[model samples]
Target: MLEKLPLGRPEIVVENGKQTTVAHSLKLKSAHIDDRLLPLLPTAMDAEQMRQRLAEHFREHLPNFEFKLSECHIRQVYYHPEKQCGVNYRLVFDNGNGTVFHEWLYGLMIPQGSATGRFERAAKRVKTSRVVQPFLQDFPPVSQLDDLQMILWLFPHDPKMKRMPDAVDPDFMKSQINEHAALLLDLPEAEARNWHCD
Candidate 1:
């Protein structure tokens, strides 16, 4: 079944000095996965841990790359240790070809002693707000956590595809997430604090 379906989603294919979005062959960044591989994802938030997970999957994966905070204007901003379980972590990665990639990670766990009924009730109240607005019914693919966590990486689309309002663009979405975090979380001025990586 896995071999019958394409190994990965279609992405921009670079031709002879011209770039076009096409269904290229399998590459780690673009390769789709089945349930068996999801368990390899990093369970912790440490930079090393995350890179290690990626390395384990992609042979050519680069663990060394310069990255800035998701929110550059903010200083000393970090995720809340205890509340970092829910949908979070939006990051931008330079593809080294003048194209940028956007990656989003999400996981929402009901706290201990919190009944499912109460959690569902709270989810209903806040689902429409900026906090988890992107998550409602999105049903994004789970990351390596095997259960509640999932990740989605957005690649550059063709010009017409990009023109569509719902086109995938990581930087734009990252800003929206930052803005939502600032407002909903009541973060400090000039700083964006999160329950996980920006």
Candidate 2:
């Protein structure tokens, strides 16, 4: 299991002399691989299978969230005994009420043998397994259509790092959301694609 960890503070960005802080990163916990499955890595399972296994583990162990491997948009996966094993993927959810939410997950598998022991010793704390928490306490909750649209507005910015979109008016956009919320949320799927960063 993984222990819960904050994804760090929101990043501050300045574009065209205006500044804004973005908050959208998902919180994650570290999870260790089962010792019994150690040998399967270099033998029974390839990179894709390993990713699948970890994703399934999360879905099975975590409560209040759901994801199908088929619906996942896996962006990266890599494993190596000498360094680390990690996976990054995107998950989308629909509330069936004209509201949808999307989140990105990144997990790093525990390193084995001496490295694992060293990490624990260095931190001077015993590690505990935990299920991932989807959002930070400070994040705005999606209670209605407007809230969902606001979250969607944040999709293009990375919460963990400072980034400013080109030609964007951070303060103006924030101020104008109430005026444009309905039109933005009612946009067709094809037109809405323009809102996301490429």
Deviation (Å) of 131 in candidate 1: 19
Candidate 1 lDDT tens digits, 42-104 = 243333444444434222222343332222010111122233222234444444556554443
Q: Which residue pairs of candidate 1 clash? A: 79-194, 86-107, 142-150, 143-150
TM-score of each: 0.25, 0.30
Report the C-alpha lDDT of model 2 over 1-198, residue by residue, as the tens digit.
Answer: 113334542221112223322223322122333334233223112335534653444444444434443334444433444344334445544545555556554433333343344333422321221112233222221111121111111222222222322114345456455445557679766665455421
Model 1 TM-score on a 0 to 1 scale? 0.25
Alpha-carbon error at 188 in model 2, in Å? 42
Runs in model 1 lying further than 4 Å from the true structure? 1-43, 54-84, 109-140, 147-198
Against the unseen true structure, what C-alpha lDDT does each candidate score? 0.33, 0.35
Error of 2 at 6 (Å): 35
> Per-residue error at 139 for model 1, in Å?
12
RMSD of each: 20.4, 17.4
